[model samples]
Target: MKSAAVPRSAPAFTPRALACALSYCFIVAPAASQNQPHQGAELPAVVITGARFPAPAAESPIGATVISAEQIRRAGVLDVNSAIRKIGGVYGRQSLDGSPDFGLDLRGFGANSGQNLVILVDGVRMNENELSGAILASIPVDTVERIEITRGGSSVLYGEGATGGVINVITKRGAGAGAGAGQASGYHGSLSLERGRFDQHDARARVAYGQGPLSFDLAAAHQGTDNYRANNAFRQKSISGGFQWAAEGTRLGMRLDSARQDMRLPGSLTEQQFIDNPRQSLTPNDHGSTDIDRVTAFAEHRIGSLELAAELAHREREVRAAYGLLFESAYRSRQTQFSPRLRHSARVDGLHNEFVAGVDLVRWQRDTSFGSSASQDSKALYLRDELRFAQLSNARLAVGARHERFEKDEANAMLGVPAGAQSQNGWSLEGSIDVAPSLTLHAKAGRSYRIPNADENGYRSSGALLDVQTSRDLELGVRAGSDARSVTARVFRHRLHNEIFFDPTLSGGWGANTNLDPTRRQGVELEGQLSLGQAWRLSGQWQHVEAQFTAGPNAGREMVLVPKNVVSTRLAWTPAAPHSAELGAQWVGSQRYGNDFTNTCGARIPSYATVDARYAYRVGAWEAAVSGLNLGDRQYYSNAFGCRSGIYPSDGRQLKLSLRYQF
Candidate 1:
């Protein structure tokens, strides 16, 4: 699938975005909140714009948080997941390996935690359509410069899965405002190395240069672990390259991101395996590997009052895994996707409005050797509008719509699934109002529908065809604070119709999407950051979630793995020059649910908490940090699946230390 080129005019960056970004200084003026500390002890200040451009997070018209590079270093984050997990209203949970297998459950929404949320790398979508899931592992943290998280329904600005929220991973860019001519065109780069228990070894480096009218950046990194347990080893390598060009009224760029991982996971264990020996399996039943390649290009031009941008991308992924005794059965899959989009912007009066409409055409061809068999194609179109309310304290509202058509190809005879086609359509709307200089309120409600995959809808009928899956959601949020103290909270609810669950006893691999049941999720979240003075800072977030089968055949049953509560907190101290200390903790509620419908275990996953501490020291052009995770030596299962009968044990307490030098 491809997009037809259209001759269009360029759109210029509006002064409003710049104005809002600058407003942070005034809005957070010390005199306004004189009681707040300014020097002795405080949290480091951070900034972010939930929109395309940059803005101070507190002034952003949405529930958002900005995690700074300094904070990332203090927490010893190896991945974006680890950083965001420390934020409130955000929950990242996955199997032991920390692969894309993790799910992101936010604010009572995103129960399945897959594609329910949106992941953007410098404004590009990273969700996979095959399983409608996000590939978190595809992005490497070493390449990231900052992360902007907008929690709650955001389908208005973004297309789908904005149901829960949006995470924008902004990469490093050219010099900031203070740099001089020589520094502006000069070079910048860093190199780092790390070693730890479990045979872990890693090295990374990045370099960049900004010259007149042109700027470029390139980065590469590699990591490997003999792993903490038998049959649980992994290795990975990644490279990223990007460039930007600026002219009188044009800004153009392209980026290429690629990665590959070779891993071995001990297959899921039955209850007996957990009790016998958490890591004793040696039948070679646990092993898998994944390969990923992606390339994306984008261009933007600004002409007078108009702003325009275009994007195109191609990606490929392949996975091979072994399971069962002696690796008897296995699942192998390969998938490819391509997308192209165009956006336009403009301004009007005390009201600045921007329009963006585009087509996302995808041809996903997949080959699976075991379990589900299939191949398919999907095409979609979407349109969105963002309107700024200059008269209402920088308020803004946005609305968007999307439509898709799907067709399945290929069938597995033994599986009894036939080829079929399905079409799906959806629309979303959201609005935000900044009521005061220090506070913003936002709300959104939208509907999303997904046609079942070939394996779900067209499975042959020695069985029957299943129905499509549908969902509706509503969200409200408020964000208030200043440079010294900030707080953000959101409440949300979602109702899923035609819920699907695999039922092994019934027929062809279990339940179908056609099940006329309703699954409902509701929750609340709170996150806050405090800068006590210049030396002490504290951050904390809490979430409450309740998911149940409402008004359905499975009424009253709590959704599997949908934890009822999660909380995390962090503290950092930088009282003296060249020194910083940090502490962090995470708590996960109990979870009980199995892939197989029959093996339901209402057992609560014993909620567990892990603590970590870090210390950093700087000398000249070099900086060093040492850290420890799971300091209490906590032992527990990472994930539970298959009706409480199956579980995957995560690694126990591990130690990691690193050092870095910059130029």
Candidate 2:
């Protein structure tokens, strides 16, 4: 095995992205000096992105964004992946299982997306301990109430795996959901059906009942698609429900969810094959199947500015798959988790103060048909405190810390490994101040870490454990908004030590997951939304990241699969009546292909842009929508294992029509 001998051109930073970053100063000028309350309505209504913390959105030390349920319906987003991409401004690559499940990258942590970022459903960790990552396709958008995205290292609150960021998907519980809007104490039901290209079909139904202090609902969803590529068919079925009782600041709930999925793998193609017909599959008969069951119980109580909250969850997951038409295996894992936390507010020395503390206990075990079994147990304790002074223009200061320990035992029927014990410590300091009525300034510095997971530890070039990954993070940002406009701008950098990643250039191309030398990730991010007149609105995001090895063999070289520039913008006509329309465009800059660790790939993965749109009509308890994805019919490949020959081309174009009825 060898690195590609020829070199390819890299994408130059675009002027538009630079201008978008530069223009933030101008947009905040007037608001920078005016002291006033937020009097205007926002696109999604600002809220705390991370559920663990109760701080206001404006005072958050990190970049945060929220996408509401109404926004999801207007955009015709069908899954969590699509909602994250189109509305949250993250970039996602089509997964082998299809569009609904994707590998989403944030802040340029490419290739190992699932490891770097954290995904949560109702405050339960969804990320797995394997390279296969989380199962996201099965979460129907219709069941979601909102999605919260927070950027920068959040290990102090989410655990060791949150170096990139965190995304929390909140589900609807009827009754008091949506702050009591469109929800009353009564019976409710809804049904939805959809059809699209490539024989895609979907059905979803929900039934709910709410009566003073109690709300219960049940939902089921089914989806099937003969995807864009040959032999790439996917099918999924899921049923989920929950019941909640709330009254006088006390809340109690229990949720149960189950899902199954089956898909045929359509391997990769060579550069020549991609150029000729990207839709063809090299390995047509390969396939996979997955089954998952999860249950969670949660409780919260409030008393005298003191809040107590907790969640207990248990999950079972199994996957059987064949890759490259030869390798075959089955994996089964069960996880049980208990998380309890509380928030307390107090006034001391004439200043307002807030305090938070939490504990996490997790037990996970796994068994594989390939003669392997492993188990890991962890315990963590964390605390955070913030102080606010009204005399200093409502300024706030905060600090937080976390300490976690892990114990593991793993082995193979054919091979043996030593049991291990490890621990990680993290800390953060941040502050924010209201510079003007509608403008805020903030900064954060933190230290974060990640321990090697079961799968990564299983594959070793020397048959030994890998190193723990760590990073020092820094950020500076501003948030400004008014009646008709809103904007957020931030510049951040992370200096890393022992960054964990797979090295294709290792062990003579046999490939191994290993920790790399010193590395750095730095970038600029801008997000804004503007209301145009009464019926029109515009929203967009621009991001530029530099991911490079600072030392070692690949020193000064760009990391694989990390695009340097990405831009997304949308224009919408959202009148108050019967018709609504939306148009969106995304341009992703090119970067080196996966496995091109030496930065010698013959050709970089080419840059590409996609256009999508939707139109909807509604008339009393019923709505219909027509939507299209990749309307440009762009031919592109976002993933490749080693080089050009390992390319997996993305879908070209597709359309969908859906109808919904409420009763």
Candidate 3:
């Protein structure tokens, strides 16, 4: 490895210094001149995740971020996790086994990372009701059209497990409306290949066809890597297809997806072992594999001012794991879901009113080792109303409510627990006012809940069933500027009760599921984007959070693995047509270890910063790019197990070269 002119260590800057520097940059930024385009000339792009109907970010009551496919390509990111990490108020860490799947933490809920966040694909819930989080790797980047991220408590409209936020991924199905309206018939395709360090290889292909009210899309991807550390190799293959038909005022669509993955688990290293050599493997013989398949069908019809939509989906997954010579396990799960919704738009006394109501039913069953079986059924009904007061400077008011019932049946081979049931209800209210031509003020208050999954309840025999976790949140924010330049800042506070988590101090050395006392989380997020002339752009994000146990044995102690501050900035230069380049840096603050909940161990992880750069060129139908990650070769740990074991080290400096051909 070669060193740059600057020192390898990150710059020494305290939180206060960082904040002042960023604020200075925003204040002294240059303004557009006579030759530059007007800031508000173009309307903002619309988002579909948090609003009753698709609305622009400037008009949205909730804090949201939208990432388009063009931005993903410019950033040279191969996975969804990498793309999301650049956003504010969102953080993620890979599994100890070094798999592509990532566990996300939103709003400082590190203890319930997987269960607190919600993930969706085309409005379909993808977050499994099991121990594992969403299978994000199964969806290829080439198939994604856009990703909408709503940051706040969203349970009133999205159902349970949205105490933190929601991520909705929308995939491409066809060309423009002209093609689907019988105006054109054509076929398009693209093929891409990438190679990087650690013997990594990736290949992807996509094809689409559209003709006279019918369209079809198919995509497939394969990736394999000999990872940086021992016993951390992984291979995955995924394929997806979609078909859609549109005629008159009705539309129908169907989608199918499948994925398979196999990987070796390196486990966690001890503190001394990490200092000696981070590349060493602690569990050389441990391995895991997963197979998944899913199918979904949906339809929508419009009549005058009323619209109705329905969807049905089924999914199956199989997992196998071998823990060295200790033991091997096999598990299988099947899930089915049905959703129906209705939407109506009307004018009531000069006010534009939009109403949406929906029902969701989901059933899941799992068969584990020792002949143990567990099943759950969830039913929810929700309604939302949005009123645009044309009489009051176009101000908006939105209200939503939801009711859910959950039933669990477990035939535990060891505990022999019977069936159980739980019920929850929540509501939310949001309002936005246009204080000025280019400024908007918004406030929202909401309540959300999350129920324990089978694994969290008692899948380990030593664990026991836990109560539902509930939260109340309040937020106020402001949005200024327009499409050319914009700034958004939000401050939020949340109080949670009956927070369920794994306690290593209980059940001897083995952890058990239990409810903790009251907890509190408060934070501030700031995001800004500036268009510097026609050839340059700048974007920045900063987040500060304080999460603590308000009333518990660990009262006033900060939560583990929840960093207090995160900052990121990027600069993009497109000097001319067909050529572009970008440089970015991210800084993460130090955090407490998982087992050090009491903050009495006097041990903490250190902070780290990394730089990334990408350059791309395009000509005709061919494009090529080169990207570098962790340019400083900084050593850092993204996650940890406990005080007894070492942390999970992230990958070192690496480079990739990619080529793509489109027709």
Candidate 4:
């Protein structure tokens, strides 16, 4: 074996001291920036999706990080993972397969991160009911307006799978210029082309035309790559078209989107093999393909202080995977969703107040090549209200609650798997207060629940299904800032019972997903931004997490594949309007290997750090940019399914250049 074997080692730091410092520094600095933005103030918030309405970050408790489209473009990021990972509190593990479906972890959920968070696209649930998780790469970065990452359990409004947090990606469409952009008029469009390492090629274009109360738009993108590893190539293409109309206080819109992709899977490698040659393919013939189509229709009406909105959507997806001769399969799924919501704003006893109420109904059905099938149905209702006392430093207080019910059913058998039907309910409560105009304090308590996905239950030891997993969540945070300099600091804890995960040692070494002993996850997240003068800007996030079992012989043992510390920072120089440059760095701390429940690996996925830089020049309607990833070309691995093997190394350094034109 090579020296790259992961090693378990204690990090050098004191959590208590750091936590205190984080709060003190942020609290005191707000006063300095009140008259003006701190230095380089963090990007101004366009909207706080965490509130489920048009509210600014200073008025909301969740205090989410908002990544703008301009930031993504300037950094030359191509996917959602790369676009938002720098915000500090979240960690996106590299995809094990050829797809860009990064398993994003909020507050250290480990291998089952997909089941601990919710991802929404314009209010449409992107998470799948089964193991197939959300497909982030399907939405081209070019079609994004902004991404809101609320890093804490948000089940009160988002429902289910929001124990860790929620990621809401707001896509750019003809449906108005996004939150608070008001109504756009005239015609707008853009075209772009890019090429990079590994024989990668990408092309995209979008156009929008608006006149009076009606507007329409269309967008298309295609990407192909030889990939960094052998047999890990893919070709993908997507197209979307939409139309929207607005008049008086009423608005309506509809959209249709489709995508197709074909990819070759290189599979995983043994530790020694990966160390020898990270790009070699262990299963050269493995490959797969997927297709998805979706449509959404929405309407809204506003009267005085009251507003009503609703949406109906349907989607279909099919996937085929071939893992050599006899081990091949196909999966298909269908989903439907209907949501209705109402918002009213007014004043009670001379105090400003607002209330929001909503309902969500969803259905999902999936079938596998092995003749097994599963279905899920959900119904939920939620309500929240905010009251403000302008006479007292414009202080505000808000509270929210939600109740949801879910039903699941499964049939047939794959690999002697047992099927069952089950029911579950979830609920939450959250509140926040503004102690000062620039500083807000928030506290939230919630209960999160999840039923086993079809794959998680496939190998249950008994005919009875695995128990429904649940967690008690608590979070507290302080948000402070002026214009340029701002800070968001938070501390959170989640105690989980019946946590579901895969254990390779179970069933005598034959891996199987199962519910485990009680476990607890606690963490601290801090994000701050500062700008000096007009040419330089600084921003970043730092996170520390502890995930461990709370019961049994392995009590207090750290969970596998959960990083202890992650930091992302960047420095940008915009000396002038036409030329700009940025340098960014990220460090991921070490943790146990996947499925290492016994914690006997004696080794951990080694900690690694990387740097990236980008430079761009613009003139008229044209722009050109160049970027480099992993400038140091450090060799490391973030994905390992076991202590002995199943290692997937990270990508080496790569370079890219792109050109874009806007009109």
Candidate 5:
């Protein structure tokens, strides 16, 4: 791989730090410029779909990065994974089969990375766990209208588990202007079919229409493929539908989504398996299956300066899998949650003040046919207020707090454990100050605590209590940029207490839940976008992470899979009227440590880089595109943890072509 264009400097600012700085700096310029006094029929107020108040992206105070719908269509991305991977400061890890179940490494946080990043679908959080973490694999992108990305901890306005950042996925809404300016009225829809080089086949369709106050959207998709390798084959089916009703001061909506997946489990093995026959590590009957269903109903009311929103949702999830000769498991889980929020915007003492408050209540139940059955409940209330100090040039201050409680119930008597529960309370404070019209500084320091899950705390046939994981994170950063160029950088440090992990030394011998040590992770990221001309654009980024087991039996050991370096670059060209071209490449460094700390890979897996290219053309109302993934055909392991068993090589060359029409 070519060396990075930017010089490698000491890792000072991490992803969290850079994100904070960039966010503070980016939010001011556009909003201040858009707020300048204007005349005549004020260009129809643009509504920011992710926020409660009706504010334009260019006028809202919250730091936001918008990805236009046109961009997605032009890029010919299949789902959310392809859509956001190109964005700077973003990293992802996928299964050997390249399915959507990926672990996101945003900035520096690892393992269940989405736990700190919140995702909202039309202003409602998409997180399903009692801990409130995002389930990216379950979210369908077919109905997404736009995406608003806010870098940095958002617990102040959003609730817990918002330490990394917030990514709001806005769904299509009617009664607003048509997708294209001056294209109101009429109906539109699209259908696409894709067949890639590796026997990958996908078919999708969507339809939508609006007359006045009522509108609806329906979409469905199916994808299947033979194993990229011996044990990587998989199949998936999904369907979703939504309806909306809007009037002068109120809007109501409902949505239903479901997904089913059948996956072959390619289990990795010990040193013996690698020396013997690696291909034999995956059994013929070893497989994993999942089914998820969700329903949500919400209402919004806008009365003058006050806006009120509320939502009720239900979700059911099931997972079945077989693990080598040790154990075969089947898990069923259900969750119900209620969220209500209120926002008020007005001029207080001649200064623009926005206050947002909300409450979340969740109830979740889990049952393992051959294991344990348990139920957990949690509730939280949070409030945040942003004040634009009147008369202060490009300055703003924010304050917020949250209160929470957790409870649990046990039903499996064989475990010989009594039914007991634990409660945890935590709070956070965040602030941002724009120093100049183009530069801004931001900081957030918060304490987050999570109670142990049923399996971690109550299930113990051998009489052992699983430890709870808790942490305190402090972050700071700065960002600067303009129309022609933009740069973002950040630094952060996290301290974990009693970091419960897998024990890896029991009868079943897998990583069993246990709090064994203290750990820390800190890093920095630098990213920039440069537009050389109207038809030419260049973007690049670099990240460095350093995680340590500061104290405990694992002291001084580097965290697993926390690579020291990550980099990427992209060049886009639009030379003529009907065609556009793009070339991009990404590099991922090697990572270590095995399924648990006890088992470790002593050698580096080697770093590898891959390239992607695309060609797109438009003719009247019809658009066509062809794309190639891993054009370089570089041989690498996507899942190095399982590579020793030869079960996780990256997919071979994949090519896809698509065509769409607007009716």
Candidate 6:
């Protein structure tokens, strides 16, 4: 499927959108107060991810954020990245190729962020063994029940690729057998349609049924768009389904998901080219397509005070791309994973304790058209214990450790023996205490590691395998406030060694994977939210980071593509029943470019701010919303290549109108 190119002179807001907005306003204005509903109520506590078992975020020692399904619907965002970007201490940018995939940065890892951060769906690892990172587009927003983010290292609980943090996306599931079977007798479903600027169109449907010991859910979605820039268009289709069965003491579940996407890549623009016309496509002929299929099955059983669970999952993906008459390539990857966990709780000497142990095994293979084929096998085991001291002001302590091994094999012997086997171990310790009724203090320290991936270890330019990247981190945090409002502040520092990075100075400027000297990343994060009455609410976050090499040629230089300061704020109003509006602003500070690791290029990306707004109304089973992004029409770039040769521009002003019906 293809969409016609949107003209450059198209207006940001069309007449039809304006008319609809006016009509909605007229219909909802007078009836607002008549049906006024309660607002500013506190939400229920939810389970936090990156932990052995379900626990409230406020009680966990780790810094975390939970984005609820209601919030996702209110924001009217189509992509998971956009929904996550609204939170604090997170930086997300579109990929350079103009695909829906996003490059994420957490804890100031810069270009290595993709490998440092771990993303999961329903507790299944989504981070591939390759360099493409997570495919956030595969899981549609309609299927997400909630998303949980845990900042800082979590290798003890989640294993590898969690040096920076972890993001776990939890999907919706049916109720327990015999609990809601009578209430679920009827069909429940929802349909949504969205139309936006740049000729963008989206349609989605979700349906579910539950009876006795069986329940099922199915969803499908399609989206197409003629993007702002020339030769940058995208079309995507996805379908997903889930089934569950419950018995006396056991529950079984299975899920199947698939997605296909085709997108035209406009490439990047030079500094002069950007200043002249940001929408022009220098590489108009570049394009790419991707197909993905995944299936997962899980079972759980409870006996006395112990619970046991196991999962088996498989995923396959194929990618094809052509780069403007220069090169065409095809790649395929298949991965299979198995994990089993056991948890038990008990009380020892008046101290409540929970113990958890898990084992994970994963094997994956990749084949590329460039005669590069490789397979990887990884095995890991982890154990954690949490103890609560009710006699000591509700103090809590957690300690955990993990061990992992990696084996790599090359299809061709010419690839230099496929890099040697690698192994690493990590551990974490954290403690928290309640000083007062509304004040808590916590401290944490941990060591984490990440093994090199196929592209990083088996590069054709250099037939050498890099050592595992390792880091030690320490953090102190304070949280104070009541359930109605809260404030959180944290200070953290990380010392890194053997950091793996691609160096353009090696292998005749084609770039090679190399390990860097000692480095450090220290930062502070502040976040607060308040309710000023029943109708108004406000929240904001501020972060500052200093990331640099400590002992190297680029010593004392800031890391490339890492901003020093970032700020975001939002204000929301709920005047009456079924009506709400939110306005948000985000400011990003300037930073060095990708190829200027030494900070001697005299080139720096400038700072910029953008404003976004959304208004939503719901009555009965119908919802209507209008959202505007980059309302100020700001021009900014998230990433750039060296020498100012390739800069990727962000989208300009865009407005979307959506309608949803549920039954």
Q: TM-scores of all models?
A: 0.84, 0.93, 0.94, 0.92, 0.84, 0.91
Q: Where is model 4 poorest over a 10-residue stretch in terms of lDDT?
A: 1-10
The segments of candidate 4 whose C-alpha lies over 4 angstroms from its true place after superposition are: 1-43, 56-58, 87-89, 173-184, 413-425
User: Rank order by TM-score, top first?
Assistant: 3, 2, 4, 6, 5, 1
lDDT of 6 at 605: 78
lDDT of 4: 0.78
Error of 2 at 275 (Å): 1.2
Q: Quick one: best lDDT, which candidate?
A: 2
TM-score, candidate number 4: 0.92
For model 3, how does the per-residue alpha-carbon lDDT over 1-663 read when each residue is reduced to its tens digit?
332221133358866576666655554456642247633222354544445344455455367788776677778777776777753326777566566666777777875777888888877888877778888888888878778888889998788888888888877767534232222457887899999998888999998888778888899999988777889999999999998887776878899999999998888876677666777787889999989999999888889998888879999999999998989999999999998998898997989888899999999999987576899999999999988887786688999999999999887656555578999999999998888877888999989988988877763323346788999989999988766677788899889998877776777767677787898889988887777777777778877889999996788988888888878888888776688888998888877788887787666766778889999898999989999888878767768767635577777788889999987
Worst 10 residues of 6 by lDDT: 1-10
> What C-alpha lDDT do the candidate models reach, one value each?
0.64, 0.82, 0.79, 0.78, 0.64, 0.79
lDDT of 2 by residue, 1-663 (tens): 122212223335473644555365336444423333322224434455433854555544356778888888778877888889998889887796664788888888888878889899988898887786777776767778888888889999889888888888878877643223467768887899999999999999988888888889888999999988898999999998989988888889999989999998888888887777777887876889999999999998899899999999999999998876578989899999899999999987668888889999999999998777898999999999888897888888889999999898886636555578989999989888889987988998999888888888887655667778999999999878764677888999999998988887778878888889899999988888766656776778888899999998889999988988888888788777688899998888888888888888777887887899999898999999999999977777788776777888888789999999978
Better of 1 and 3 by lDDT: 3
RMSD, every candidate, angstroms: 10.1, 4.0, 3.0, 3.1, 6.2, 7.1
Compare candidates 2 and 4 on TM-score and give the better one: 2
Please give, for residues 57-80, the per-residue lDDT of candidate 6 as tens digits: 555436777777777776677877
> How does candidate 1 score on lDDT?
0.64
lDDT against true structure, model 3: 0.79
Model 5: per-residue lDDT, tens digit, 441-539?
Answer: 777677665445565565332454444456676777676765445676667766767654445554475445566578776776666655544566556
The digit string of per-residue lDDT tens for model 4 on 1-663 reads 123333334335434454455445544544534444332234666565645665665564455677877777777777777786753336788776666666788889888898888988888988888776788787877778788888776777888778888888877645343323543667777899999998888899988877777888888899888877899888989998888888888888998889999999888888788766788897878999999998999898899999888889999999999997669999999999999999999976668888999999999999888887887788888888877777766665666777777676766644555444555555556656668766777777777777787677776655677888888988888877655656877889999999888877778889777888899999888887655555666677778999999998789888999988887778888775688888988778888889788888877788888789999899999989998888877777788888858887777788999999988
Indicate whether candidate 1 or candidate 6 has the larger TM-score: 6
Error of 1 at 498 (Å): 1.7
By lDDT, is 3 or 4 better? 3
Count of steric clashes across candidates, in order: 27, 1, 0, 10, 12, 0
